[model samples]
Target chain A: MADKKKKKLTPEAQQYQSYQEKREVKRPIFKNCIKAFFVGGTICLIGQAISTFYIYYFDFTEQTAGNPTVATLIFITMFLTGFGVYDRIGQFAGAGSAVPVTGFGNAVVASAIEHRTEGFVLGVGSNMLKLAGPVIVYGVFSAFVVALIKTILIKWGGL
Target chain B: MLVGHQTWMFKNKPTIISTGTVGGPFEANGRIANDIDILHDDMWIKQDSFEKAQRTMMEEACQIALKKTDVEKEQVQFFISGDLINQITPSTFTGKTLDIPYFGLFSACATSMESLALASSIVNSGGANYILSGTSSHNAAAERQFRYPTEYGGQKPPTAQWTVTGAGCALLANKGTGPVVTSATIGKVVDMGITDRLIWEEQWPQQQ
Candidate 1:
């Protein structure tokens, strides 16, 4: 028992001693921070640019331009998702990109691809709703409830 | 998969439309001769709170979709549904309540389209006489998985698609005159290494 104890300590002490003897390489947190900042910032900037482009080039009103901008964003995201590039961005930027409308496209395409390996009927056909399923349910129900209220208001309250 | 064809005889469009009953009642609309039941139980919350809401919403949507399609509960050859929860609780509950040959699917926002595509294919191929495809999502449930809560006050960028907090249902039948689903071309998963670093920096200064 005592010998086993010494043997364990020997390896542990050697490991610790080697670690202490090695030169400590200081990694600047700012490097990753900077990378994240620029990469994240650039994505937002592009979104803003697209929105501005819709407003300027497409001559859309500020409010109306939003719709076109979203459309453009979705379109681009769909393309990126199709090419299998958005997933990498998602891993690097984390929630920064996945939280946007583009993420919706990613979720859709990712789930579809995941299911596709199962074959058309059982795979892609069924797995497409892996992410966006809840969005549709809430959308429809909320709209239905809102529509119900609107109907009540129109009929009785006279809005 | 069995390759077989079955056709039904109908005089008119054979379409059913139900309204004011969540989705609608096909029996009331005179589309289906038998009674099509709608089930909504609060007991689902105990099994899973998130799925409870989703099941409620999906049940309502299926009720409506069934009514609209004029398909009877017994007549439905298969039911397909999906949600964002584990094992797709919504779809499972839906399958249980309907008690028919059914399947549950998950594909995120593309669920409705996916379900419909499959239903159409099955009906067209004569593998099924009547098929139901449905998908549902809840805002609270989705936020927990995809983002922060609404109370989080997170600024939504212009790129976000306002999640439709509802469910959509469609019925496919060999007897209907509506456009048949001939073929479906599914979208593939593609990725580009465009970093969102710039977007994050511009949007959230505190994070920087």
Candidate 2:
């Protein structure tokens, strides 16, 4: 039978396995949540600051300023991605770095920069979408579906 | 009650035979750069990915630690290490190459001391004759995963901290001719009654 022939680890191997289990550190879920919460909120606070900039300086109302604010944030993020500044913030903030629209820009430009040596078409163009691929695909599809439902409600339901 | 409430003292003195440190260019230019055992001029370490480079440095640090002493990699009982990246991938991947028993740890900034303490305890307990304790963090890789890429020109506020780029490994043996591990007290868990209503409970409210 296979059971009789089954081999066991040598003493050293057994001890090694035992030590690995005994000494391993567990992930700190609550601590990480706190870090992510503050860092993420800070990123949002930056976004709000940018939105306010557009509203106060450009004479756009707060409600109307959101559109340009997102664009401005993404623009700043892209530049920060280029200048190597965002990364320092990301290191301290962790999830704070990824929770903003800026993070999406960072992801795209990061992969592009990482793969720049591979040439534009094959490297930057392709790799930029690699992480964003799923998000963008689902985003468009969901939007289309939602728009279709809205049209149906407005036309057929006569609401 | 003794020196500090958070510190624990190991019964046995775990001597550190040797240490291996690998630093990138920035650290190479630091005050202790000349003191580093091995220094790489480039952050990539000629690897395709920053994370991979971190792994290579960590492995090299371990190898150097073992090499400094008569102990072969095979003779080492275990590797206790981790990194700043998600999942502590660099340390875990290096563990794969070392092919020794490994305990992937993540204590963020304090990981180096944390591993040393744990290794001392294990060796002191007679669980093993030798253990490797270390941690590594790459400037570029840590930033990429946690913040922004190198190219991002975001202006850092005056208070922002910098990542420590390099790996530091120490070889702890039951008997050796070096500094010994005396005692290690674990950290304290403080609760300020900041409740579940705080969405970002993992982080402090104000940190730039």
Q: Provide the global lDDT of candidate 1 against the true structure.
A: 0.59
lDDT of 2 by residue, B6-123 (tens): 6767767789999999999999889998889999998788988788899999999999998898898889999999889898999999999999999989988889989998898889
Model 1 chain A: which ten-residue window has the lowest total lDDT? A20-29
* lDDT against the true structure, each candidate: 0.59, 0.77
Q: What's the TM-score of every candidate structure?
A: 0.42, 0.58
Q: Best candidate, lDDT-wise?
A: 2
What is the C-alpha lDDT profile of model 1 across B31-52, one tens digit per residue? 4423334423332323345546
lDDT of 2 by residue, A71-159 (tens): 88788888877777776776555556765677677767877896675578997887776545566777789899999999999999998
The runs of at least 3 residues in candidate 1 whose Cα sits more than 4 Å from the true structure, single-residue gaps closed, are: A1-159, B1-50, B194-208
The CAPRI classification for model 1 reads as: incorrect
